[model samples]
Target: MLLLICFYQDQTSLLSYTAAPSPHPSWPPAPGIKLCVFITRLTSRSFLTLSGHGYGVHCCCFSSCGSYLLSCSTDGSTMVWSSDTGEAAAVLQHPSRSALRVCAAAPDSSLLLAGACDGTVALWDFPSKTLRRCHPVSEASVVACCFSPCGQMFVTGCTYGDLKLWDVDMSLLYAQKDAHDLGVTCCSFAPLFQVDGCCVQLRLASCGQDNQLKIWIVSQREGTACTMKLLHTLTSQSAPILSCAFSSEGDLVVGGSVDKSVAIYDANLGTLLHILKQHDRYVTAVALSPTMPWIATGSMDRTVNVWRIGDGDSRTGRKLPGHSGLLLAYWSEVDVQTWLCEEGLEELVSIFKANNIGGAELSQLNKEAARELGIGLAESLGLRGRLLRKIKGLMAEQSGSEAPDEFLCPITRELMKDPVIAADGYSYERESIESWIRGKNKTSPMTNLPLQTSLLTPNRSLKMTITRWKSSQ
Candidate 1:
């Protein structure tokens, strides 16, 4: 059974242009960064801290019904805690493993999987407090893990740039290895997928160092070994991708990156829908709250931030705080995107409009406007000859055109400090600079009257010009 409940974001993003006189723009940053935070120290209270890991929680997930909260740590221990009291319910430890990156419980709440720093996956029965199995992985660190919705299979993200799939029984080769440019950072297997005309099957979703998240379908071709086909490739968030997860509905995907925030995307279409920003640092971890319409994040800042889920408007999402160390995160999926060429194109269009950026010709328009402004200023000033030459040189030195751009005197090659009139017989006096400069124009040797020149030129006939230079002699 799926819930159709929609969590309406009651609060509007303050960064939204709605309040600004700038009028409504478009989607994407439809509102700017709302100047809002999901978690604030003054308002948020600690849930509970499971000591002994020597660090704060990195990743956390709930069972099928929100009965138990499973958490992993950088200190190399995975703990099962009661969702009610935040008390440590069970502690699972591996002596050799030093850091635990991710721990996820199966959708049915029967099994728990942990990806550790030592390149190994640890499976725990939970009820027996016994290790059901432990498998050695390659050199790439296990950055993420999750159980498919059906729990028939599990996958691990290893640094070797591949997603390794294993059957729950651990008997045969479920999936040998898959492709990614850098080490695979995270993997999620869609527990429920339709295959071969109405037959439900399992598929996998993965995120890695390449800054893209991919969807794979397991297909057994005749005369060829069973393989996961690269169904779709997505791009939106900038990398190194920190985390990715699916909403319970599974039609949507959320991911974070070194870019400092998370993005919402059409899962079926690899287009970006919205960008949410709040965390102080890179969003290293994220989790989706299916029932509550919330998404949680842990970052390098040692905090867990819970945000409103869906595209309700980033400003109003309720934020909750958790943890004490640099928060890394793990994520899971709810429903996988259905592959339909038409639907994919529609999604692409929607996301395209959502993150709408103007075309490349915008650069040309800016350049033209700047050129016009310079021409207008030049025509108004009525400057010519050496004066124009000096002004152009000064503008060149400034490098850019701005309202109050710097003007470097062409001869000095230094910024114009105190400009003065250069008419009349050469005269020097210790006096107020502006008044003295003005006095020179009031009376000139040519005519004991004000100069007709518009301060654009000076009568240098009797001027003593002292150009400074180093003499080789």
Candidate 2:
């Protein structure tokens, strides 16, 4: 479960990470908002889309200068999209496995990489329109990977706690087995902080299923690789640390958690500084921009939030529409309408029954009438059987109902059903609402972010404060 009020920020060109929380009285804390992976692009704009996948966009990154954008999927596909036109430049597909994570243009412009659940890192050659190659990682899936500043090397972390380094030639150099006691969900190489020439002395940060943040300094010596020691291990008060990233300063580490909160740490000491509790579900992604003063985050709540850092407490300020794709459900008085495209009355009837209304009531069909009333893309059936007439509208009289809308905005108190439409009259159909509930909406513990952080980071250091969205009265 994750949500970002906005994803208009980044780190490669480097301020990174965000969440909901308060800071120590004087440390100039980072602002926080709940929902994982504070999402942000270099530009403060994003297109709301809903037609491609049943799931929300997962991995998003920009080219070196923040020119081109790229994203991949759990549905086994990768899309390179033009930021200017919002059109797909290419779509790379996976076999049975889908990409779990993606690393955008390395310092080199010719290549891109995607980490897959199948324990393989898939590489792309921009010039050739084909999948260039794949390199096996480990028994477990690779969840996170990052490139070094020079683009000379890359590191991949597996869900089973292994971190492996690979040369550009795709040969293994260093493999740290059991990088975490539990699954390792994210990994990054410090940008400016370099090692004493063993390829690179990378500062590595990892978050995991173990509920702790682990940091290590790795370097190569005389053809032998060495790790300095565990720099720090910050244990959480609640759930495991799910996602983590570094700030441009190389001194801050931020992360999202399963506990429904956003946490900030002094990158050097692993000191917990701020926390954000503005979301009601697990935070999925977090992002921050070095040049910009704002932090944006997304969540399973289907909303993106923005905050200011520097206050020990998360000073929440804005919640924006994170998704633009609308699922316009057009309900009509007519009982028989088109929902899918296919032929055959009897077979289509059975198909809808099997797919849409699973385990729904079944009866000997009136074969002749079914042929007369097939549904289409432009039509909708009655919420229930129209034959029942006057008393049928009361849902309590029925056995059960459609899975109750997956989302309910705490602020607007409206059911986020499918098909949001601004109707001819001033009424809007439930498209945006439905997309939020079913698409991005998740059921993790992260949704429970703190609404107030006065007890945490106090008086006036509030970096960015979210305008308290009025909740349901």
Winning candidate number (lDDT):
2
The lDDT for every candidate, in the order shown, is 0.50, 0.50
lDDT of 1 by residue, 349-391 (tens): 3322333312221112233342443422555343223333432
Relative to the unseen true structure, what is the C-alpha lDDT of residue 186 in candidate 2, on a scale of 0 to 100? Answer: 74
Poorest stretch of ten by lDDT in candidate 2: 321-330
Measured with C-alpha atoms, the lDDT of residue 70 in candidate 1 is 69
TM-score result, candidate 2 = 0.56
Residue-level lDDT of model 2, residues 1-473, one tens digit each, is 11122232111101122322223222122333222223322234532331343333446666655445666655456666655555667877755444345555676567788887667888777556467778787777777887766676778888788888786678787788887777787776666666565545667777777767777776656566544456878764256566777776678777766555566678787776666656555555666555434455555554445655553234344322111100111111112213222112333445454434311122222333333445322343441233222123222222111111223322122333222222111111244323333433222111211222111112121111111212311
Per-candidate TM-score against the hidden true structure: 0.57, 0.56
